[model samples]
Every structure is written in C-alpha cells, then in structure tokens.
Target: MSKVYYTPWRNDLEMVDKFNKILRKSNFLDNIEKDDRIAIKLHIGEYKNFAHVHPLYIKGLVSALLEKDCEPFLTDTTTYYCGHRFSAVGMLKNAFYHGFSFANIGAPFIVADGLGDDKGFSVKVRSPLNELFVPNLFREVDKMIVFSHCKGHGLTGFGGSIKNVAMGCVTKKSKLDMHKVVKFCYNDALCDGCDACKDVCDREIPLMENGKRNLSLEKREDCMHCPACMEACSRGAIKLEELEKIAQVLPLAVEGIYKVLGKENVRSINWGANIVEYCDCMPFPGRTIGKNTGIYLSDDIVAADKAFLDDVNKSTFMIDGRPDPEIQTIEGEKIGIGKMDYERVIL
Candidate 1:
C-alpha cells in the first residue's frame, strides 16, 4: 500500500505552515535534488475564477523546492476549450494575473504546450488511451510535482490528482481524444441532411452522404465532442453520449504520464480546500460542495486522490450528474498507477 499524508483545514497562516510541515514530515521532497529541473504542474484556473487552488499554497511549494537547490517552474498546458487560456500567450497573461508569476510564486509560469502543440511528443500506454500526446516539456524535466484542487468533476465525480494528470498533463488533441472514446452516435432516420450540423461545426465534422448527416471517419479525428451537432439538431439525429471519459481512461492517462515522467520522480498533492461541484476550467465554481477538508500528499496519485474522494463523498456525496468516485481509484489500481489500498498518516 502507498502512503498518503494528511492535515485538517486550518486558517491561512497555519495552512501554509502545515503545508511545509507535511512535506518535511513525509520526506516527499527528499527525492528532489540539487539542479533538478522540476515541472510544478498546476491548473491556474481560467478567466477571473478565484476558486482555483490558492496562490499562497503554491508560493509555499515553490519556496520549499527552491530551498533544495532544484530548478522549479510553474507549468500547465493550454486548454482545448477556446478562451483566455486557449493559447500560450493568453494563458501566461492570465496565470500571472492570478498571482502565479515569478514575483509572487517565485517561479516563471510556462505554458507546457506552446502555440502549435508541435513541441510535444507521444508515449504509449494501456488500452482506451493507447497513445497520449504529452507536451515536450516532459522531455526536459527531471521531476514533477502535481498540485491539484480536490473538487467535483462532471466526468470523474470529484477530480483530485487523477483528473489533473489525465486532462491537465497532455496536449489539446489528447484532451479531445479522451472524450472521443465514446464516439459520435448518429441516427440516419432523424437526420434530414438539413446542413444544420454542418453549418454549426467549426471543425467541419459533419458530412453529407446519401442525403444523410454522417460522422466521416476521416474528419471525425478532429471532433472536439463539443456536441455542437447534437445541440444544433432540431431532429433527434446526432448524439455524443457522455463525452467526458475521465473516470474510465483517467488511469491510463496517468499511467501514460508516468511512463514519460517516471512514477518515482513525481509526487502528487491534492489541496482539499475549496471543494466544489465543477472543475477549475469552468467560468466559476458555483458553491462549496462540501466542508473544506485539508491536504492529501503522497508519492502515489491514486492513493492521494482516493483519500480525498472518501472524505468528500461521506461529507456531501456526488452531485446529481457526476460519476461514481470509486471508478478512478479502481481503474488507477487496475492499471498500476498506484493502489487504492493506502495508509493515511495524519501530519
């Protein structure tokens, strides 16, 4: 069983202190050595969203890493979603605005997948996500630290460490690939070939064949599963059932990330405060899903997320539309990312 370190929610001052204490006690940073180029993977939330993992905790993490004489940089990939974070230029501006700059967090904020997505390389993993397009940034980093906010997720119930890596580690194409596992469903009967789906799609995914709307295999690769065709159809034609596959394929994505960045070279930290019904990628978190919990730090991503999942479920339960929280843990254990069976040591 893997080990997970824990501490209850405390006030701001003690919170940062306990963050450092927990790291020291757990000895999680001992592996990070002098001159190691480390990538601090974080999701600096999009556009005016204040509920992302607090900057104070992130600053503390940077300070701790620097003390060890390792090279650390705050990094995250651009979103597939079009917004302030769609491109590297916009993402940097927003991250700096959110207080993740070198001045505030003591590290430069770098967008892992720059403008073209050409900088990344691919790595093979288990089935479901046989290959993942990860940013080339992993090619240089010696170690990684994943700092994720524990909260409700539409696909994986509550996203902690697992969701962060699966969706957050890879490039734009891989992000869409995870969602596309549940391919586009089409009903030839309902499709009128009205060009409604065609007109709406920016990717030009819909096709006209035999006077019926079709999801052409050639063009389908680029499908964002945005479900624009499904929404635009006045008729009951196109269906992209459950586009978010974070629960089923998340572990594979995590395993893929591990394959590139060796499992031993990374540590996962889930900040359990600001628990909410949606992920940070959203415009805004609506409300607290449960009482604020503390932090879960571990060498094992699966173990860390599992501890966070257990608490949030008992306190507030999954939201109406979310998936079973155990799915990610079960799958992660199945794929050997880390076992669900873990010992939680209170810090």
Candidate 2:
C-alpha cells in the first residue's frame, strides 16, 4: 500500500499555508534533482468554468519546486473539443484568462502539444490499441508533478491523477483513439423521433429520416464519440456501451505515460476543493457537488486518485447516485500501474 498525505482545508489555517504544509510533508522535492526540468501538469479550466485548482495553490507548488533548485513549468495539452482550448494559442489565452498566467503561477505556461497539434510521440502499451501518443514536450521534462482538480466525470465516473495523465498528457489524436472504445449504438426500435440527438450533435452524425432518427454507418464513421447524444436521448435509444473498455484503456494510457517518464519520476497531487460534477472542460461552471475536503499528495498516481475518490464518495452529494469511481484504481492495479490499497496519513 502507498502512503497518501492529506491536509484538510480548515477554517483555522490559510489554504495556501495548508498546501505548503502538505508539500513540505510529502517530500515531493526529493525526487527532483538540481536543474531537473519539472513539468507541473494541470488542466487550465475551460472558458467560463474557472473551477480548476487555483493558481495560488500552484504558486505554492512552484515555490516548493524552486526551493529544491529545480526548473518548473506549467504544461497542458490542447483540447479536442471545439472551444477556446482547441488550439495552442487559444489555450494559452484561456489559461491566462483563468488566472494561470506566468505572472500568477511563477512559471512559464506551455501548451505541451504544438500550435497545429502535430507535436507528439507514440509509446507502446499493453492495451489492444497497442500504442498511445504523448505530447513531445512532456517527454522533454525530467520529472512531472501531476496536479489534478478532483471531480466527477461524465464518462469515467471520476477525474483525478489517472485521468489527468491519460487525457491531459496526450495529443488530440490519442484522445480520440482512447475514446474510440466508447461505442454508441442507436436502437431504432426505441427511437421516439423526438430529434433530441439531432439537435445536440456537433458533428451532425445523427439524421432525421421521415419521422425516425437514423444513424448511418457512414455517419458513425464521422462520429466523435462524445456522450452528447447519449445524454440528450431520454428514450434510451442511443446507448453508450463498452465503458469498461475506457476504464481498462485509460490506465493503460497512463501506464504508457509512466513508461516514458519513469514511474519514480512522477508525483501527483489532487486538490479536493471545488469538486464539480463534470470535468473542467465543460463550458459552464456547474454546481459544486462536494465541500472543500482537502489536498491529497502521493508519489503513486493510482493510489492518490483512489484515496480522493473514496473520500469524495463518502459525501452525500455524488454524481448520478454514486457511479463506481474506483474502477480506475482497480484497473490501474491490475495493469501494474499502482495499487488501490493505500494508507491515508492525516496532516
């Protein structure tokens, strides 16, 4: 079992000080050598959804890394969705708008994937898909500190360090490759002809034929596999199957990242504050589903995420009646990434 350090967000202490205490206790800087290029991997929130880990907290982390004489920089990949984060320039602007600017975080902010999304390298994995693409910049870093904002995720039940490494570290092409496992089947017999799927589809893959909604094979080829249609269909006609494939493949992709960076060279921190129901990629700022629980720090990404999920699920307000968030941890352990069993050390 791995040791996960926890520091509760209390009224008696300043949050930044609490974060500093956690960092001091975690011994995170021990992994960093002098002049080591450390990438602080994190998601700068989407436009209008500024619920990610606050830049103040990141400033604290940067200070700690600097104290170790390590070179630290903030890095994230360009998003796949059609939004402000779809390109490198736009993503940097969005990150600046959300207060993750260089002046604020005390580090250079880089979109790990290049301007046109062509800068990445592939790594072989145990999954049947065989390989996953990691951003070229990520490979250059000697070490990484995966800073994640723990929250509920629509596809994976929960998003933390594992999801951060799987989706946040890879290029858009690899993101789509990982998402290809989410097969959506439209049952024509259960179609209500409500045109809901047609209205929400950004790719226009769903068509209205006569009075029924039709998803052609050609259209399926163009499908981006986002769950927009699945969420819009109230009649249960469009069903998302093979979600276990996602649980299995996501950790494998994370393992690929670990293989590139070396398992001992990476550490993770999950900020359990501002726990939103959906990912930070969502355009709108949704409601917070849990209170400011605390911060989790661990060298093991899987153990850190497992502890975060376990703590969040203990709360009454869980997304979709408490879907199994532990699936990622279970799969992570099965693939030799990390262990689900952890020893929580309260600070």
Candidate 3:
C-alpha cells in the first residue's frame, strides 16, 4: 500500500517549480526532522557524460530540505574504474566542477567512503536470502534521499534508484568483488601486439604470445585484478570472461543496500528526462533515446523505476515514436526491499 507521486512535465520545465510541487504533494518535507544530517544520494555524472540529474534540480531539492531544517549534503562513493570519480580527490573535484558546490546546489559534497577509501562499513540483509551484497557507506549514513537520473545501461538494461544505491553506496572494493566475473582474455585476431595490457599490469606478468599479449596469471592470486589493463586495451582485444557474474553482482549489491537502508530512512526521486541508453559513468555523452517526462516520487524503488520505464515507453520520442514498455530487471522482484504494486497519484 505504498503511495507513489507522479509529476509529468516536458523538457521545457522549471526545476524549482517542479520541486515545490513534488515536495508538497508527496509530503516528503513532512518526513524530515530538524537539523537531521540527510545524505542526498545522487550520481555526479562522469566527465563529458552530461545526462545526469540537473544541478538546478538538486538546488530545488536542497531548498526543500532546508525548509524543514534538514541538513542536506550531496554524496556518492567513488567508482572502481579509473575515471573522474574513481578517487576521493578526483571525485570531489569533479563534483565541484559539475556545479554541485554548496553555493550552487545549496549542499556540500561528501564522499561516503573516506579519503583513503576505507571509511565504509558493511551490512548483511535477509539473513537466509541467497543474495549476499555488502554496502560500504550505506550503513554509515543517518538518512538518505535518493535522486536519480533515469536511463538505460548497456549492461543492466535500466539504471534507476535501485541501481544508483546498489552501485553508488558501495566502495571500490565491494564493486570489484561483486563485478568480478572472469579472468582476462585477449583475442589474437584483434591484438596488434601493442602490449598495452602488459604496460598497465601492476604485477608486470602478462607476456606477449603468438604476436599478441596474452594475460598470464601465473601469480594471478597476487594480482590486485584492478582490470585497468583490460580497460586500457585497444581494439577491444582484452576482456573479462564473466559478463553474467558482473550482472549478478549488481542485483546482489542492491539487496545489500536495501538491507542497510531498512526501508524507513530512504526516499526516492527520479528525474525522467534525457533517458540515455547508457550509464552516466561513461567518459562520453550518448544520445538521448526518450523524451523528458517530469519527476516521480515513491518509497517503492521498484515501482518508481517501473513507472519511469512506463513513461519512457509512452514518450513521444521513443524508438518507434510510440509506447513500448520493456525494461528487463537486473534481478527479479525486490520483494522485501519494496513493493512494485503502487498507487500512482498524478500531481
């Protein structure tokens, strides 16, 4: 019996106005306590990937939180991959540069994991459930207000609030462990013997074979398995063997996040415009595959995400320029996490 609020609008929309309407109608402001340190969880888009939730929208959210005397801070953990937000220093710099400054969004940025990347704690959810994911920073937060930029991912189909928390709240180590699928592999057909993998390998072990650099894991147990070499490989020759395992990790990680959040302290808001078919973590911006719908508010992460998918399908700019809702879930129903069956009240 969860209530989800829908506020549909076009790209030509005023974020501040939408914010006030949504906060008021959804009674989100009513749930806050004065001076509570609220972690406004959100994705600060990777460099050159600009389809993230708007900073202006963040400003409006911050303003609403301030009205209730809630102390809000924009926060997200560093990614495992090497990128603008891969480390605390780099992440903070990227946050500020992306207009997430206290002066701009009316909230300070906080990296959930510590400077050295060891500030996170782990929590186990669904004692007997098969899924086992551990969140680094989710357990440390007092409260969380998730703001998501709805989009599709090449790997997980759709990226929404659940995906945001599953990936966003964890540490790099957790991400790596969860995403680890297979060992490194190189295609001789594509490899021009550039030895880029060898150059990036921390252990300096992978050697060239048959005119191609084949990853040698003789001391594979000693390797940090950062996969930097795999990413750096040109011609897409080097790859990890475990796509299914990496995909399996996202859902398990989500279950862990839910166990930590424990339902009460979490609220989700999704900004549904610029629905790109890829994650914002990419270094390059991708094309928008759908039209801008307004905001959706719900405590049910699954339902709100489903609502977002439905809106995108119904958007005028869809693939066929018609409604075609088909979003494959990363995992099956998030049963105890939240209900997919929701009452959507249009605002």
Q: Pick by lDDT: which candidate is best?
A: 2
Clashing residue pair totals per candidate (backbone < 3 A)? 1, 0, 0
State each model's CA lDDT, in order: 0.82, 0.83, 0.70
Maximum-TM-score candidate: 2
**In candidate 2, what are the lDDT values of residues 1-347, reduced to their tens digit?**
78999888775248789888778876656778899999999988889788888889899999998998989999998877667899989999998899988888889998888894865887888856688888878768899999999987767767889989998989888888877887677789999789998888777778888788877887666677777788788998887776657766788888999889999988999999888877888776467778778889999999998887777653433344333677788889998889988899988
Q: How far is each candidate from the true structure, as Cα RMSD in Å?
A: 3.9, 2.2, 4.7
What clash count does candidate 2 reach? 0
Model 2: C-alpha RMSD to truth? Answer: 2.2
Report the poorest 10 consecutive residues by lDDT, candidate 2.
Answer: 314-323
Instruction: Give the CA lDDT, 0 to 100, for residue 68 in model 1.
Output: 92
Model 3: weakest 10-residue lDDT segment is: 319-328
Q: What is the lDDT of candidate 3?
A: 0.70
After TM-score superposition, what is the CA distance of residue 246 in candidate 3 from its true location, in Å? Answer: 3.7
- Show the colliding residue pairs in model 1: 120-136
Q: In candidate 2, which residue pairs get closer than 3 Å at backbone N, Cα or C atoms, i.e. clash?
A: none
Could you tell me how far off, in angstroms, the CA of residue 301 lies in candidate 2 after the best superposition?
A: 0.8
